[model samples]
Target chain A: TQLLEQSPQFLSIQEGENLTVYCNSSSVFSSLQWYRQEPGEGPVLLVTVVTGGEVKKLKRLTFQFGDARKDSSLHITAAQTGDTGLYLCAQTFYGGSQGNLIFGKGTKLSVKP
Target chain B: EAGVAQSPRYKIIEKRQSVAFWCNPISGHATLYWYQQILGQGPKLLIQFQNNGVVDDSQLPKDRFSAERLKGVDSTLKIQPAKLEDSAVYLCASRQWTSGGPGGNEQFFGPGTRLTVL
Candidate 1:
């Protein structure tokens, strides 16, 4: 079974602080996706990084896939309180056809105003 | 376009009781998925359906849990004789089947049904 390891399981920071979370795995993936989830709601897709060394930005959020496809990272710039939520990284293995995602434990972010 | 829909946003039942949750996938989406998410954890895939046929159900606890996607449009998940450990949020997601893609399909998620077994 493939497992994703997420770093800094929990984070608390004041508004305007910048932070980064990471997801790593020994197995290579065909693609990686990032999601943000708030309390009482299901996770929403943020972005999907398919190519190695790819970077996509959604306003204040920046996501990157590693060159080797074994790791990914999410960076938030000047975060606001609205950014407070759970961040998760999911991977589609090299040969998975059903599109079933293997997810990391996730990083819980708390931004204080 | 409407996103995925789920019924009974919250359900509280006693241990050993049975409970069910419903989900309506987005129109034109051929694939559907059910996931169980414990607090402070990522969602775990319980089952996947391609139309009315099940594609994968490897992670589901078959002894107590059962799910069906009838007509390939709507689905229901049931747990009989629920246990305290069964308490968690059940999320339903759907995605359109594209011929090919570099990344894979993007899934649209529903609000999820929170289940608590006392």
Candidate 2:
């Protein structure tokens, strides 16, 4: 079984501040995905990084895959209250045509206005 | 496109009782997944189905939990003799596997059914 660990389980920030969350694992995954979840709702897909050292941008949010494909990061610039939610990083592995997802503990971000 | 749908957004049951949750994945999606999310933790894969065939259920507590995807569309999860630890949000997701380009493996999630065992 593969496991992903995320740092700073809970974070509280002021508006316009910047923060970064990290996901690390000893086992390499074929791909990694980032998600943002709000209270009383399921998570929404933010991005997926497949290649090592790959970088993807979604507005102020920037995601980076580690050079070893065993870790990933999420950086948010000029954070706003709307950005307050749980950020989850999950590693997906497929044995064949079937896929199984492994999720980290998740980092809960609270941006105070 | 409509997202995955789950019924009974909330459920409250007593310990040692029985409860069931329903899920309807997005149309044309061949894969469906059920996850269990405990408080302050990420969701854990409970079961996975590929067109009504079981894929991986290693993490599922089969002792009392059982899930099935009938007709390769809708699915249901049932728990008998529930325990206090059974209280958690159940999430349903669907995805279609693509040959390449990240494999289109992203799982789209439903609103989730929150279960409370008192």
lDDT of 1 by residue, A23-90 (tens): 99998877889999999888899999989899999999999999998999999999999999999999
Model 2 chain B, poorest ten-residue lDDT window? B97-106
| TM-score of each predicted structure versus truth | 0.96, 0.96
Q: What's the TM for chain B in candidate 2?
A: 0.94
Clash pairs of candidate 1?
A: none
Q: For candidate 1, give the lDDT of residue B53.
A: 89
Candidate 2 positional error at A1, Å? 1.2
How good is model 1 by TM-score?
0.96
- For candidate 1, write residues B56-113 as lDDT tens digits: 8989999999999989899999999899999999999998973355577788899999
Summarize candidate 2's per-residue lDDT along A14-94 as a digit string, tens digits: 999999999999988688999999999999999989999999999999999999999999999999999999999987776
* Best model per DockQ: 1
DockQ of 1: 0.65
